[model samples]
Target chain A: MSERSPKKTDTMTEAERDAYHAEKMKKKKAARDKILATKTEERGLVIVHTGRGKGKSTAAFGMVFRAIGHGFNVGIVQFVKGKWGTGERDVLEKFPEQVTIRAMGEGFTWDTQDRQRDLAAARSAWDAAKAMIADETYKLVLLDELNICLRYDYLPLDEVVETLRNKPRDTHVIVTGRNAKDELIEIADLVTEMTEIKHPFRAGVKAQAGIEF
Target chain B: MSERSPKKTDTMTEAERDAYHAEKMKKKKAARDKILATKTEERGLVIVHTGRGKGKSTAAFGMVFRAIGHGFNVGIVQFVKGKWGTGERDVLEKFPEQVTIRAMGEGFTWDTQDRQRDLAAARSAWDAAKAMIADETYKLVLLDELNICLRYDYLPLDEVVETLRNKPRDTHVIVTGRNAKDELIEIADLVTEMTEIKHPFRAGVKAQAGIEF
Candidate 1:
């Protein structure tokens, strides 16, 4: 029997635990290697971050930042944020050669007031996005809040899906916003829903500069 | 009946849709402004990211990137990731004056297998975190994977909670890991559970360099 029951690990002697742990790791490594062997195909990923919580766009930008770390050319198309001077935008804009950001939305639909204008902005952003996707130099493209525009039916679903389906083999695309559609989820390789458990906003706390933006 | 149904927006004439949308936005803005009026108090927050999903640490680092955008001083204590040379670490470390990162933990429990050593590492990381919290210069502190230590009882829950409770009034602290304790969530001003809807690893996709790291 194994003496390294995680809960009772501290109770065991160091020598006893180390030997047991080492053997366990050996088995784990073997099993992992087998899995890795089967994972031979390597290509870009279609990632989605959604749900009614924070970090949907933030997490996508995190990936963009990581891509920047690797010296990868990146593109960001903000479908609804509309050049709001967000903190992420300020930092990312510093790397102009490595990153190109288009904040196309006037604001949320309510702020825009004109359905025609909102639709125009969405189309403009989508056009920018398609161009970026077609460019082989860009390794990663972030479609920030594209899901919101899709949720509101600003762009045709088929065109967007078709573009993603035909994206370059080595290009990675991340879509962020709440309420991702069924078709998008169906094609995504990874999806994370940031669920709000508690928010300071409900407790009468206003949004802060760096933390919220 | 109103003519600006979101799904039917493109079908309506520009004049008709603008009038309807404008009226709707006016009422919405009034209601929103009322809520904004009540949210007058401003202070730093205790934020927690936990769940069995991805993006807990990724989202936390995203905030770090945003903070860097504003030139806010940040301290990152990575309890379990160790010095794996993660992409976020490489990028954030570029701004040495603005950010200090400590990748303390050796590895996951299974990888280390030394219970005593893991305990020692956790204590060391916690000590560093406490020092960061006490230093008034740090505007934001990210306790990366601290919840995993707490979940495994490596560090006393009460001490962690107390330190966070007494953190500087304007110093925001973000704790990230899956299975966050209820006590931690209870005191947190903002809590988000990253729910995993889908993952590439499940489909035999290996972790990509910049995207996963």
Candidate 2:
């Protein structure tokens, strides 16, 4: 345990404040060092981005760019959102060798209004995703909106879980969408559910080009 | 509404699949044009990121980079986390002119274990945040981990809410943390909750440098 520093006030002199901050940071460093010493394992992860809130897919796209920053090859399979022209897709597509994207869905279920067609698209997307998972060449694969497919039973949950369970040891996979199945959550190494606390749509604010898409 | 395209099989000729995809995309373009026509209003937003999951702060950081891509100046105030060396901080700090960051907290409540000190830190951070909010030069201001400060009652909720409610019309504000207050959510333009579905820490996997921090 680290010792707590004395309270700081706005009236403190600059030198005094700096000295206090330095002392506090030293204690924090010691505590952090103790924790870091025990954590040494590194491996690929099965990450899930789910919930009824925005940014599940957006966050996954952010990770794609982060992974690219580290010079990792990436693959993206869109299971529900296929109609919109996203800025991320345009930017990522420019890196042909490092990125492979397959937008397989016609649209969301409500927009398409065709169960059989939605199922077909999901199956096709799943096929593409499985191939990416098996390939060690791609370090990260983002299965965008795959949870919608599973929630609607467009694809078998058991099979999807089994495939993810058998993914390459060093391949990270991120699945995004709302209503994620329990099985997928159970198998995922990291899962984030986006809760809808407040929404601009309710306030009559339309989604913007760069912000939303 | 657009009609659903007929299902295509893997056996379809390359040219046939291409033609089908092109036709579908054309219909999608028309539908999208209709929606885009109605979305003419543009203004600043009060966005909230809350939930018991990873990526709440990560997603907010992503937006900072995205805003930078559009040539917008960004200000970041870390209310609870200030001790760790985050990769984003290092990168964003390089662009000193475009990005201004003030990591104000000594640490989290559990780490600091001092209520009066925490309250003092929160007040100081809030003052800095209010200054950023009033500055017209910053297009986006991210109050990182602000929810934690509010959750602990370190600052007055009414004052924070009123300030955000009266923010500049064209300046966006993003507040990230878990256990967001209901009053803040009520006034927010967009709210996202990151639910913890799975966490690698629970599985004994250590947080990575670029990934977690």
The local lDDT score (0 to 100) that residue A144 gets in candidate 2 is 87
Q: What is the lDDT of residue B23 in candidate 2?
A: 63
Q: What TM-score, to 2 decimals, does candidate 2 have?
A: 0.72
Q: Which stretches of candidate 1 lie over 4 Å from their true place?
A: A1-34, A82-86, A105-109, B1-18, B105-109
lDDT of 2 at B77: 93
lDDT of 1 at A104: 84
Question: Candidate 2 on A1-213: residue-level lDDT in tens?
Answer: 223235544568756765665566568768877877777778788899887778887777667666665667898998866433445555565467778998884744444555556667888889999999999998899998888787665788889999999999888899988877877878889988787866676555777644665
TM-score of chain A of each: 0.88, 0.88
lDDT of 1 by residue, A91-176 (tens): 88778999988778474555556777788888988999999999989999999888988876779988999899899989999999
- Tens-place lDDT per residue, model 2, B154-187, is 7898899999999999889999888888888888
> For residues B1-213, could you state the per-residue lDDT of candidate 1 as single tens digits?
123344556677868877877787789878888888899888999999999988888888888888889889999998885423456766776789999887775745455656567778899989999999999899899998899888767799989999999999999999999888888999999999999999888787787877877
TM-score, prediction 1: 0.90
Candidate 1's displacement at residue B193, Å, is 0.7
